[model samples]
Target: MAETDKFAVQPHADATSQQQAHSLEHWRSHTGRNDIITGLRAMHVWLALGWHDIRQRYRRSVLGPFWFTLTTLVMVGVLGFMYSELLGQEISDYLPYLGIGMVVWQFISTAANEGCNAMIGAGSTIKQIRMPLTTHVCRMVWRNLVILLHSLPVVVLLMVFFGHSLTLEFLLLVPGLLILMLNAVWSGIVFGILCARYRDVMPIIGNLFQVGFFLTPVMWRASDLKERAWIADINPFNHLIEIIRAPILGTPIMLEPWLWSLALIFLGFAAAHYLMVRFRERVAYWL
Candidate 1:
């Protein structure tokens, strides 16, 4: 009787171990792509929200979103002349360069800063609705993109006045913009979760942005740094900005910028997907 009982218990223990292994495999299998798919399906909802976000912000203002245009022009005018003289650079060449760099930087900075609040800003909605949280990040990106478009006239005006011509190189901007947008989306998702989990992270991000602005090559040219050019070479932000700015300026895009940008795009989305798979469920409670 004892020998028979021992054999029967061995089979039961094996079965329990197999069942536990299957459960663990299933839990680890989720790739988080579902969040992206669901958000895309609900495009109308987020697109409209994005549009409404713009309208609501400027609702009471007469100039509306044109304020972005006005502000950009003023900065270009003041900084353009000041930097041209200060750097002993030609105003014609320098102004257009500064304008393009500044505008692209504005788009990037605004998108990233807003990304930190992608989830927290929608705290009420996240707590109440069952919508995919990625949608909120999408909304923030679209809103900033629209504002960037409005600021383009400043770039165009500077180019035309400075005698820069559009060449076939302009086509490179499309791929560059697409890459930047992808970066923005994934970056927003990552920062959104971190900010929601620890409110302290947002202030740290702000300080980092201030440092990044000075570190990036917007205010100065890569040639100015010469042997120290590796500073820009290693900066992923500089590469993304250059991809767009070089095309706008009708200059050739460097091989290094493209390499760094493509590599970053792959890494950024992969990391974001991993974060979503792990912590997405906990976001609501953390809020």
Candidate 2:
């Protein structure tokens, strides 16, 4: 009878161990880090989806994505000419500066603008599918990156036409682009959550972007604010643009902008991680 009791107790202990392991798995699965890791691992899904979005959007159009290249050229030509004249800057010097800034700003602004809808726009899939919610945000950022690439040829042409030779500093654009994309990811998660919960915030973001364009020194030079340099120094967008723009224009890369950009990355990810973990499960319902 004692032997029988021992065998029964052994099964009970095994059951309890299994239950504990299951609980541990569940806890880890619910973490934000897990979500990010799983989402990144599912890159094939987001990559295909991002490319599909671009192809579908320009499906019937003849020029397709090259339209971005043409638009960049016209925008730079028209604005570069007018702004250079009005600001009393030489055209040769100003065009390359304006072109690089415009291209970089387009990526930053477009990623941000679309990021607001990252979760909301994928509403149907979110409800029906059980994937990491961050996947949608990654898709949004990747789509904007594609657009950024399409517009890059304009930057190359501008540098060539304006006689800005490639220097070792031009390689700085690689890391600058990476940092920009990382910032976009966190911003997408944060803004995506806020806009999903508060629909009205979307239009507010749009308006802010319009004002930000003029305020951020995209068209205007930061050096023009000589006496009151604090204005540009205070704008985070200015630092973001400077990181990429300075590299392309072969200007001295300032350590301050790099510091600010890195600081923003850490702070932004902290906020994003909190919101993601807190609301990851509820995002589908919010959609």
lDDT of 1 by residue, 153-176 (tens): 668677877787888888888898
Could you give candidate 2's per-residue lDDT for residues 1-287 as a string of tens digits? 99999998999999999997985565346556567656756678789999999999999999998898789889999998999989999999888888888988888888888999998999998788677777888898998888888887677776777676878898999899889988998898889999999899899988999999989888888889899878999999999999988888788889999999999999998998898788888787787
- The true-versus-predicted C-alpha distance at residue 204 of model 2, in Å, is 1.5
Clashing pairs in 1: none
- Give the local distance difference test score of model 2: 0.86
Worst 10 residues of 1 by lDDT: 23-32
Using lDDT as the measure, which candidate wins? 2
Q: Give Cα distance to truth, residue 48, candidate 2, Å.
A: 1.4
TM-score of 2: 0.88
| Count of backbone clashes, every candidate in sequence | 0, 0
